[model samples]
Target: MGKSATAATLALAAARTGRSVLLVEVAGRSATAPMFGAEPPGYEEREVYDDADGGSVRCRSITPDDALVEWLSTHGFRRIVRRMARSGLLEVIATATPGVKDLLVLGRIKALEADDDADLIIVDAPAAGHALGFLRAPVGVRDTARTGVLNRQAREVLEMLGDPGRCRVMLVSIPEETPVNELVETSFAVEDEIGLALGPVVINGIVPPLEGLDEPLPSGPPPGVSDVELTEMGAAARLRRERVALQGEQLDRLAERLPLQQLRLPQVFGTTLGPDELRTLSDALLEGVGSLEAWA
Candidate 1:
């Protein structure tokens, strides 16, 4: 949810600036789809949001099997594609290849970008540990297949990923102990392993400061007439305040350690994030990171 929120916020920001944006979910995850209150996106692209100015954001989930079938179909191997899909051999092959899944997904993204399908594409990449493998797939294939179409495709994808103007990798994290630590480590890993600079570190789930919680509590509940209940409520507020302070401390530590730009998204207090909450998040992102025009 943390990473997906950041991705969706960024997509909305870009769309507001009159740009056609594509929000992609890699790693076969459903985080982005649920945020938009839609069924999880399948292999094909679907419009998720449309703005008044004729700008829109589309979402799609890419998987190795689907990409392979699409690729084969384009090459006049439709029957083979169907056979592989129906026989369950596609999953086996995708599983056997270490980074092919990631490479296929990257190829899809590059095609979308190159074909002018979207002015901007925001990818909700895998979590830190798996993301490293995903980012390295292009380089791995480029190095191994030196004289074939695969090698050429890999080279192109690598160029797109390494181009700062074209691609910016953002790391999303929460203001918690483990997520913060993983963000730091993943930042380093991305730079060292993938040779790409992180654009920003989006810190989500920030607890808003509690107002009027510091004042002295009344001796008794005004209408409920239960001192015990009042005391419990006060205790809960104090605990929430403490948590907010701790999160602030964690943010400070992250700022001191990481040299990347940081953006904070407040903790959304609800069971699910709908259009309203997404708009609220986009507003926060715009305030913190400025307009998406700069990126465009």
Candidate 2:
């Protein structure tokens, strides 16, 4: 669904408004850095973009193992956890407890939120399926542990997730059938099961329709062009028109199925996306964000 790029674009858009933004990746992936033409960041935060104003965007990757280690170390169990980690027991611990690993990661994010680490923190969560489990982890852990520090932490994270002022879940999907179907389901799950407020849904990879696609081709080729090229061009245009119509049908289906506002992102033509493409995307995102009544 291109959430990593969306995260980067949203961070830059916020930064342009003189707001410090922290872009976090939870799955240990480094997809966002390349958009800014920067290197992959470790757990430690690195400044990827600095606007001329006081705004900036910092990025970091947070894995469950690393988050668990940091959480334990903060509670004065550094030596013990380090030994367990070395013995490969960490994997066992994370796997044995269904939602503990995810809770640990969310705990770190909660701490950042509480401490006001940045004006905004954008977490690039896992894909749709994993994301549902990711967001529901705190609730599961809280219910499992009736009395303990883990319970307390899980409850706090749950509170943050449910609070509209503190957090909002934004589901991303491309303008296609299967993705849109999954997105609609995920949106309902986030609202009904997780009880979280939703931000605008992001519709990525929207191909703008070409003009004069319906215009009939001339009988003969124009200057500096052959008849064969003209026929091929017409065929390509017709294909594009078909694709645009398909996208429109999917868009309409999404709107009817889900009641959330949408933010549309244009598809980049180049094979690779860089700073220039990122800037274009961020501008489009900013325009969409601005149009929202809540943001306004």
Who wins the TM-score comparison? 2
How many angstroms is residue 90 displaced in model 2 relative to the true structure, after the best TM-score fit?
A: 2.4
lDDT tens digits by residue: candidate 2, 40-98: 99999999999999999999998989998898789888879989899998888777667
Q: What does the lDDT come to for candidate 2?
A: 0.91
lDDT assessment of candidate 1: 0.83
Clash pairs detected, candidate 1: none
Clashing pairs in 2: none
Query: Candidate 1: how many backbone clashes?
Result: 0
Off by over 4 Å in 2: none
**Which stretches of candidate 1 lie above 4 Å from their native place?**
88-97, 223-225, 291-296
Summed backbone clashes in each candidate are 0, 0
Error of 1 at 143 (Å): 2.8
Q: Could you tell me how far off, in angstroms, the CA of residue 221 lies in candidate 1 after the best superposition?
A: 3.6
lDDT of 1 by residue, 161-209 (tens): 8888888889999988888888888888888778886687888988898
TM-score of 2: 0.96
